[model samples]
Target: MASDSLHSTVHQQPSPNLTSFPIILKFEEVVYKVKPDHRGLCRGRSSWSSTEKTILNGITGMVFPGSIKRRTGFVAQDDVLYPHLTVSETLIFTALLRLPNSLTNNDKIAHAERVITELGLTRCRNSIVGGALIRGISGGEKKRVSIGQEMLINPSLLLLDEPTSGLDSTTAQRILTTIKGVARGGRTVVTTIHQPSSRLYHMFDKVVVLSEGRCIYNGPASAAMEYFSSIGFSTSITLNPADFLLDLANGIAPDPEHASEQSEGLEQERKLTREALISAYDKNIAPKLKLEISNSRMDIYSFNKHASSRNDPTKAEQWCTSWWYQFKVLLQRGLKERRYEAFNRLRIFQVISVAFLGGLLWWHTPESHIQDRVALLFFFSVFWGFYPLYNAVFTFPQERRMLIKERSSGMYRLSSYFMARTIGDLPLELALPTAFVFIIYWMGGLKPHPVTFILSLLVVLYSVLVSQSLGLAFGAILMEIKQATTLASVTTLVFLIAGGYYVQQIPPFIAWLKYLSYSYYCYKLLLGVQYDEEDYYECSNGVLCRVEDFGPIKSMGLNQLWVDVLMMALMLVGYRLVAYLALRRVR
Candidate 1:
């Protein structure tokens, strides 16, 4: 599918933020629904939401695009998220993801700068990106940065879940002013709001009242009081519109004698007002948007061979300037993703500590107890398995929003991202863990053979890949971080026990679990490397080394080299594929 498709239903207007012109977005009979099974259960609800009833199954709304008012804003936290990224990179990523290539880097930078100026974040342009871009910038500016990201796409339509959350009244007003400015620029911005105070109530261009899933009113905020008045209901000036709307939709308590008449009057007016407003807007406003506006990019280089009026730096003759040139645009971005991983740093420290501790444990191990071998198995299982289980709970959700946006926009394919991430991280795994394996094996005086040392490193790297894959898989299905984390813990335990750490031979009842234990292959692989390639028995004497293969189908296995390589390869591919497919949800 193409990244963007525009409908002819585009309308233009102006708002308080601008004196000239802006865009307005309107929805006609739009409806949203969820399956009955997925409906929320915590409203003390015994019966699920009905599967039928078209009117109660969905919500319909309309509003000016991109314009948020002081009292009516979306529910978004105003916090910076990345400290390592410069203000430039954050915008660049958004522009790259949303804006077309027609908008060159210079255009993007300029546009972002304009937004930066508007949001009062110009001074922090070079600020490091961190959680919410917070260190050098204020929370309000960070919220504006998010607004800027949305603006870079030049969307005439904006949908915000919540915009005024976590901000003081002054900051909230400033943000609302910026949103109003967007609407004045000709965009439709719709936001869902909780009950807002009286001061904030008058800022909205329109008030859309919803009860349960039904739309009761969709019209001007000013006429809201009068609209209810005609139905013989009085609205207080101090009453929040949202709360008043809730009461109107739910109705007053049923007094058996007057209940029927009250219900009849309310239902008739509700139906009449809803239909009347829907028609007024649908016929007049919605119909006005029935025009097409195709935005295009200007070829700048040819217009100016030298940097005169246009500041185009690209050469016209350069193949990179050709149309339909689909190649990676931001090398620095890809580098950043590949350059540093929290896991990598942690892995390095882990390797060093393990190497030192292991060395001491197996020191002079010709007389060492069987505990050394047992401890090694336990350590590897805990280390490798623990990561996947824990990360599986968080990795997906944390990256879920950004991942879905980028993936949906066709920035890159899921397979490509997976492959690039895998390739990019493998070298890190090799480098970070190699020293640890070397220090431990040599200090512990285990197998010091060169081939065996290298193979051990390979095992660590492969194990890492498997773990990352599991992380992606977990993210795909779980909605909450806690659920995923708990599940991951259980899964890790199962893998560890089934991995031959607790018992070499499996009871028939849980015998099938052996196949799922990645450590089963890892133990075998490390043993094979030490057994055949290194002089392990001679070096460690009888103490540190484990002697046998930890597998049910030991006789059925192929050559140790082929068998281990094949298993590692298959597990890597298997989990990665599962992760890749899971990643498709990101799209």
Candidate 2:
């Protein structure tokens, strides 16, 4: 059989000089399955019950020693990177977070620099890894950056999922050449490619072709055409070997002798051809591969034990850096990533425009216009309430994919990430509100007391935090941007209506909701800051009336100022706790 010849050739080939830590990857009877449609709609069923869909059925093979997941570097097809970060910054952060703590910061950075040079990214090292919205690095450079991230750990085995995908032929060739260089460094590189060109196909030492979740061919790339030809699937035209193999895998062959067939017949022929190829592989190749695996001295378990005894760097602790260190790095990264969004001109314009509009409308009204003053204060509560809510709502959803990728790689503790994210945004979140309060409070001319203005600023800032917390909670709980924003919209509207501004005499059944609204407390506190219970204002009839006797002010007195502050504080902590817990549940 052709398998015997292929096996002999493979065994007779001389081993190249490998590095100290060469990894050989082997698998036997690896069965992988998943439920494709959880709702069972694919099977014409309305229930949630679903059947298992086999993706890899009894897959068996090996790449020269074996591979451990921890020691294996994986680069996903899509590059999930912070658009704001430069290529150097991206690799540096990854190295700091992913490398073992045994190494010093300088050593980690040095390693990153080496990887940058090795990956030919020195020229564009400072260029940002841009996303859909931003234009930064080229596609090839981004892919290399993704690879360089994995290379930071110096993995023995590197697994890349379509690393060359979406690149042109020249760029794809360069990427493959880089990977080949990596493989030459005693690392086993396994990648999945689709319809590679002839030049690309020849670069691979070994190739495995699968048909309907079954191995149709598992041998050297150079010998693939010969093996197929021996199995009555030869081609005369000088087609790319990868293309030919793909055609064979799809149950088609380039044969001028055969006539053009109908669609139905072609499908049946393809099925039959696939079955024949699978059967041939089972009979010819499976036995030899199984025997080789059985004869291997170092199995996966023994290799792992040996690796553990050696105290390999790849098998280091789950978290490489301390919580504080992680927090510090992530905090810096978050600040850099969000600086543009936080301080953008458009956002600044929106806040300043609204602040000035409110200032101009209220424009230093006298103390006699208590109602207008109260309206302005309520507007402050409502504006700050939803503004931060909408802005913070997109936080978790936007970073969800990036979080999942990094966390799965065990980059940092979720606590550090959560803390850094929320805390780093504090200054940015408060900046606009601080400016708004300063502008409107001075322009509206309500309560000329210095202490009163300071108190109002403090309350507005406090309200900003509470509103941002609630938005974060919604975002973390529902990691869908549209859904979270919608929920936030509904929630803020409810709080606005129930904040006791437009309606003072809320029904007893729903009066409890006002207590739940942070805006209600903030509004009451602003009024308390402006006037005392005994302070009098001229009514519409020129009668002097106690300021606290107004309907809204009377109902919400200053006696519960401490209670209101306490509630706001509780909400500040409570919502954040909810957000953190919800984030924990994310996979």
Candidate 3:
């Protein structure tokens, strides 16, 4: 019926309207299609391993028209967000991703206004999205915003799972009423539901009931009660449809050997009612009707399949290409986001503090060598290992959520997000640390050997890269921010101990740990550079000792520093690889 109307120029005929409501999607074979044999409805008997066997098979009937369209809205449970973003910016971001070139200024503004008004979030249009406002926005309002986001592109079929799952009763009813009103305009909506009250259950245009893996029924929502009555069952006046259906399906597990006469009679009546349902819909179609519906359905579904596969600006077609694009775009965006987050904050603090700290220790000659070395030790400890901890805290959690959400839509590869993040941090890594090192080297006059100073800067740059990648790997291993933070902190703490920061060298007992310390390589290079060029004669107990006897052991040590840099580089590459694997698991 929908297909013929689409190919024609005249008004597409509306489907056969139910005295109640027309079907938007059908599964005549959705629930209760499978008979109980040894395998039963879910297949392969009732065992843990076989539990998921017949999941998709039990769904029976659904009906919807080609012209009907639907969209989804969401309200999260305890939302996390960028509080500074205006409501318009949030919706426009979705628009940019979805409608980009198609949406003009007025079009974007008009669309946003419509959403704000419809969702009743207009009064707070310019207000921040987080903090007290998190609870201020009603569940229904946020749900509508989420739906508006999905609706922007004009979807033909919308599947909303647990749309009102976390809302209060009044809010849940409002959401359902909104969904029904949208459906009345000839849109197709399919949703997974649970624990619906009588009013909530009655609001659905259709229902698809799934038990364990098997679907027991799929048809008009109103017809559900009638179908049960026809099978010699009764619903309570105040009965919840979802609960009643769940309890009934639970009884399907009763053993044939132990079944009472009443149970057997009810089973027989269930079979009869199933037959009656098929006959009434004319779905147990006569030979003639089967051919008619087949031609119409074949034509309709072909277009649906085609339409579904084609890529939109937002709904990417290929995971790799989309990820690559997401990488490029996010790289640019993240670099900017990170510049504000890391550079302006850390760079300011590190550069100013390091210059002043180095200046206070600037006049140190070979006589106070131990004091100078101790100061440098604080520099390495406070700066190198700790910075990664902060980077992990701020960046990883947000990116992890973004990565998970993107994967849910089934586009963008994990490797690409990981790779982009690794590459994107480079510009910031180079800029901020370079600024700090360059400023301190000039201010402190520690090394006139410009090459050594530059090499030291590059070494720190490489270490930052390794740290960022390592943080990402840890985040992937632990999904939640708090858990990931605890692990990242613990792991980093362990690595820092092994780093030669506090202890000059790893203990003999943990001798094997020396091989893994990124701190060892980074410190080795920096300490070698400081010792090499800044020659000193130690006055231990006021006894002066000539150190030039060590010859160009200074220059020789600089050559060995390359080994540390190479080790750091390998770590940079290696940690990113592990991070990619972990992120794939997250997806």
Candidate 4:
């Protein structure tokens, strides 16, 4: 019931900086469940089973605010940030999307700067928030940057999940102290800390200890040890209260069964202590919260009435900016990030090496060996098909977390992001294939006429586009790089087999599969472009031999060339459409 009030307040907030009465966050019988394990499958059954595990068991508690605003912010356990963006850029972007439109760019920038100062990130304001592949700010600074993003929204209620995780004791203490300072400024700060030091544990105003999805204690932090001791769990004055409480909650306690005993007695003692603690909370705390729920509803009635009319305009659920604005920002960010990829030495080397090797292998063969030319054309088709697809398969999965976070934040529409990324990647996608073809075409001794050469390049480029689109779809659907890669490889191999190359016979049932394979169309189109009109190939003994009028393209027919081109174009559009739809369903 209290969460309903909190939800309404959050949606009806007028602006980032606006403040009303202090808000309360209460969860009554709130439970979160998942399908047994992360994989959503029954472990030991042949048939599918519908079983669930509760992560938070009927969690009922209150996060009563000491501040006058329901601007609740959540900082996730892991930092979700763009590796390329500078600290200033990251904060400014978040502010632009979250702060009211009435605030000018200058105002947003000022707000972001203020957050930087408040979070002690001023020294690293311009530094990149780098990730595993890149080096930038230290871990503490990155955590502060995560906090600064939320700070830009000026939230009065902050919930952080292990904000100090993976940090050194000093850094963790510093971060906790900063959080304590924030709490002292009249904000309600709740965090789920793990294995905190004694100094760190003592900093909290209140601590809610949970065990196996049940609340074992919900009271003042200073009084936790006393309460546990009162319930028959021994404590040392020298022992860290936080550690003692955790050990008591987890079934780890001092036992007399030392050297060779089974310690079943210790296990029984722990089970009893756990049950006792659970019963203690149910008897002591839940009744008070239940009583408060009714009383607070009556007290906040007048405040709710006054706030409703003032907050309605912002409650309509519109995006921060126009679709066009979102598209422009996303496109700009995509292009800036791709600039680093365009200069990747390894990719450049791979493309050049493959092109040169293909050229050397197929160098200047006379027209007599028509199959050699066909092989060269097929090689081009298969290479472009596999290469771009391979590259695209990693795109979404690599950026999945970032996309989900930003999209969830209402930063932009999925359509805006999808379109911007597709458009932004066009140049790099087109450049590599064109260059590869250029180097190999003249050296391999294919038709040199301008129209034919241009046609060949366009066909190959379109093939690359189709491959890349499929890759995007794979990445979005799989959401894991390794899985997507494996699936893409298998699918590409199937397409390659059905690509009208190695198979001399096709089963009637699967004959139509060639239409689904872009490689098939690409190869056909390339052969038609290069050798459709050529009539002869030189004999092995150096004499010219008579060949068919239409060369190797005779079997497929010249009309099918246009059909292949049309199909390649269709596949380009179809794959991208599928990719977009897959992305839309990701979360």
Candidate 5:
């Protein structure tokens, strides 16, 4: 019955009284040009020398809407969803932001429920929308969920790109059937698909074939083979109509009368090239299209109905939601996703492994052997600095695509996402280093006083945060994990060399590099907390001790401890600011 109604609607003549609301999307002589890559540093090229490709050239078509709404939704090829959020949570978040503030929470949820039922996703509504690393709903269900997301806004026209790219035939058919039901109920849906099955091909009312970005055919799906044959192409009853049409567009279709023969002469005689097809379409179809466009405009102008405008009552509302609401939602989602990643079992094991090994190697350092204490303190600074720095290099790069999708959709502000991410990982960032310090500090038999122990832990924690921020900045700036990791390693190595411990005799020209070294400040602060001036260090029996008075802190001037602390704090803010700027530039 639904298919019959859809068929009838397609063949039916345009009438103003046919439906209370009708929308027609029309584009005349549309041309889309691809911009050249601008990342290169080439200023010598002349403006007249161009290298831009045209994807769509002078194509004109009209997509008439069944309902009287202008709400259009687009589902991209990639299924961009928050992997951690469940299906219900995903739709609810979209509804909360996209639906007008006039709707109550219950009303919004009820609408979401209706869409889930309509799309046959009720069984998986509570399931997580996982990614490659995790298990979640099936691909078919995920596609449906993606569609259901758009349904919450009640769009009149829904555009989809390759909706069945990865699904099995049965699943693809089911998805198409669901979409057909939507079209039958007075909605205009335009979807692009790669080679679909014969049954699936017939499901569409009209078919448009393009070759090398040029439309060669646009007509009823049933009449496509006849149209191609009329244009000196060949087809067979045994062949899938879609396959035949595609081959015809690609200039590979066999002769209709002589299946075993290929004819170049006929192609030349018919002017069978992309240019010829485009020209033929203009001459043969443009007249019909102009009439269709004129009729659609007349029907649309007959009545002035703006259902979509009222449907989205908050169209004039700023920022989708209140500032606090966006922040709260983003914070909750970030924390949930980061909790799984930051405290991964492998990371915990690695931290513990390092701590235990360091503790055993430096066990019970004697007070007279002050050299061991200094080495251990420097190790503390470098370990936390290096570990967190490399670990964070992958964070932003991994989430970049997801960030781009959300930002393009106008989901939230870049500032909000940057702030939330920086703040979200603080728990694990502080926790891991503190735990590592607790295990090693007592085991190495360092300063055991309560104030000394607490201060040491605080210093290590702050150092880890600084490293994490640097990692974020590098990841955001590079936007690729491999490149960012390589650069981060080199940058961290340079800082380590200038950290005041490894190379004490700094040349005057490069002495300014020490101020930029996060490890330098952290090392100075940790040393200050451990030892002071006038402390005596007795050399062990038959052993030579370095020229340390056991007061590594006083030697560097005790007043500089606060300055080091202040510097590390400033670097934290500085790195985060840089990361934010990099993200803004990327968008």
Candidate 6:
């Protein structure tokens, strides 16, 4: 078989610098299990019960780092890059947020560029690392970028979970080759692979095969087939070495053509079980492997102690960068990432169309038409009320995975990230609302005084902030899009109904509920801005009636304008505080 010849010719040797700094990762008799919920009839008993399921039973192995320090890097199966960011921007941002503050920004950027070149991503470095919806880099290029993100830290021990899982055979080979180069540079790379091709399998210096939560083989890749063959299981056909090992681990015997000379026991050998293979391994291999591990412990301990005493220049601080630095980097990244969504062409068109339509509907309304003017003001409040709410509701749910991944790596503090998101969204969230109010207030012929216009604008903007904070709170608390959106819909509907414009005299029992709605306060404040206590308009009989005496205005007059502002301010701060606390409790 090709695998046989390749295994004999291929040998992996560590770099000559290995002797200077060795890092040995050793784990012994590791066992892991999980409790599964079984909520059905089991063994003819109609009862619910929980049972322990074993995933790894007494597994033991070690990954030998040739000459490396004590840093570790991990890559998950799914690549979690921002779809809007180019490859160069992605790595540069990661470097800025994660690299030590001792290094200047230019130095960190240069390091990211070096990683780009090393990963062969220069061609696509300027391309966006797109997602399922966005089209940018290819699968291979994205996988390489994921690896480069981890490599920025210069980790001595790299752990990857199924790095080549969804790639083609050729692309998978290239990934493994890159990993091999990393190993050759005196670092240790450990990865989990299933059913690799013959050539790919031969590249590994060591192989650890497991079946049914137990280690079946742990030794040099070149010696695996030989070790299995010694136990009366040799393949007669030319098969991939990985395939042959899988067949044995599955308890399927070799072909009849390669059976033992004893014909009487042929059938028994063909039906070999996992227990028999495990027994053979225990008897023949366990003793020598255990002895080697025991002997190496002392050497590994002494080396680690000596290395810790030296002043290693590459060692990073516990937090890597200061809190303010993290905030600035995260703020810049958030703004760049959300710019498109905030100023989307479709959204801008929709807002402009609504503004023009509202302006034309109530164009040049007169002061005598008090009800018409009040309705226009209330519409303003309602539009801004829900516009920012729906947009802000999706903020945290969409970024849940990315946030968890980055935070797990200790890249930044929750405070820094939260503050950046809050501040970065200010201009984007407030822009369209400001435009809407300016257009409609003048067209609808509300109070012509400059002070009234400015106050009205401020109230509308304040209401927008309060509404957005509520949405953010819902999103952070639930972290599920469907649930958060549904809750937001119900809450906004309730607030709209309780708002003074729709029902000036709410039932006494539900009157207290109006106080809980920011919409009610915003509507009252808008009315106070456009009218005064002594302002009057011609009544139906040509008699003068005080504008504040109008039904909607009378119910909520300018007398409590300051109180309404205070309430709106409290809601703004209170909702955001709730959102922050909810985010802290996540994961």
Highest-scoring model, TM-score: 2
Off by over 4 Å in 5: 1-24, 33-54, 66-72, 229-238, 253-276, 294-312, 539-556
lDDT of 4 by residue, 1-587 (tens): 01111222221223344443355666787788777534555677545437777787867777766232225677888999888888988888777666666677677778787777777888888888888989989898888888877666666678788898999999998898777666655556778888788998888777788877788877778888777777666644478777787786786653434322457866777777678878888887778867877677765676567767575434645765677867887887777666767658898889989999999999986676677887898899999999989989988998888887777666678888898988888888898889999999999998889999999998899888889999998888888999999999898999989877777367889898877889988988887777544456675676665444334455444455667778788888888898898889876
For model 6, how big is the CA root-mean-square deviation? 5.3
lDDT against the true structure, each candidate = 0.55, 0.83, 0.56, 0.76, 0.75, 0.81
Instruction: Write the residue-wise lDDT of candidate 2 on 477-546 in tens digits.
Output: 9999999999998898899989988778899998898888999989988888888888998997868998
How high a TM-score does candidate 4 get? 0.87
- Superposed Cα deviation of residue 453, candidate 2 (Å): 1.0
Candidate 6: pairs in clash = none
By lDDT rank, best first, the candidates go 2, 6, 4, 5, 3, 1
lDDT tens per residue, model 5, 286-331: 7897788877775666543544434433346556566666677677
Candidate 2 Cα outliers beyond 4 Å, as residue runs: 1-22, 34-52, 65-70, 297-302, 312-316, 540-542
For residue 107, what is the lDDT in candidate 2?
A: 76
Model 6, 1-587: lDDT tens digits are 11101111212331222122435667788899987665564577635445678888887776676233225667788888899999999999998987776678987898889888888999999998888998999888888998988777766677778888899999988988877777766666788888889988888888887777777788889899899888876877788888888877666676655567775565456445577778777788777778889998888878778878886544645577888999999999998887678688998899988998999999999878888998998898888898899989999999998888788777899989999998899987889988988888899998999999999999999999999999999999999999999999999899899888888888998799889888888888888888889899876768899887788888887786888889888999999999999998877
Output the lDDT of residue 489, model 6: 94
TM per candidate:
0.67, 0.92, 0.67, 0.87, 0.84, 0.89
Clash total of candidate 2: 3
CA deviation > 4 Å runs, candidate 3: 1-57, 63-84, 100-114, 131-136, 184-186, 197-199, 210-217, 235-297, 301-367, 371-375, 378-383, 393-401, 410-458, 477-494, 497-515, 540-556
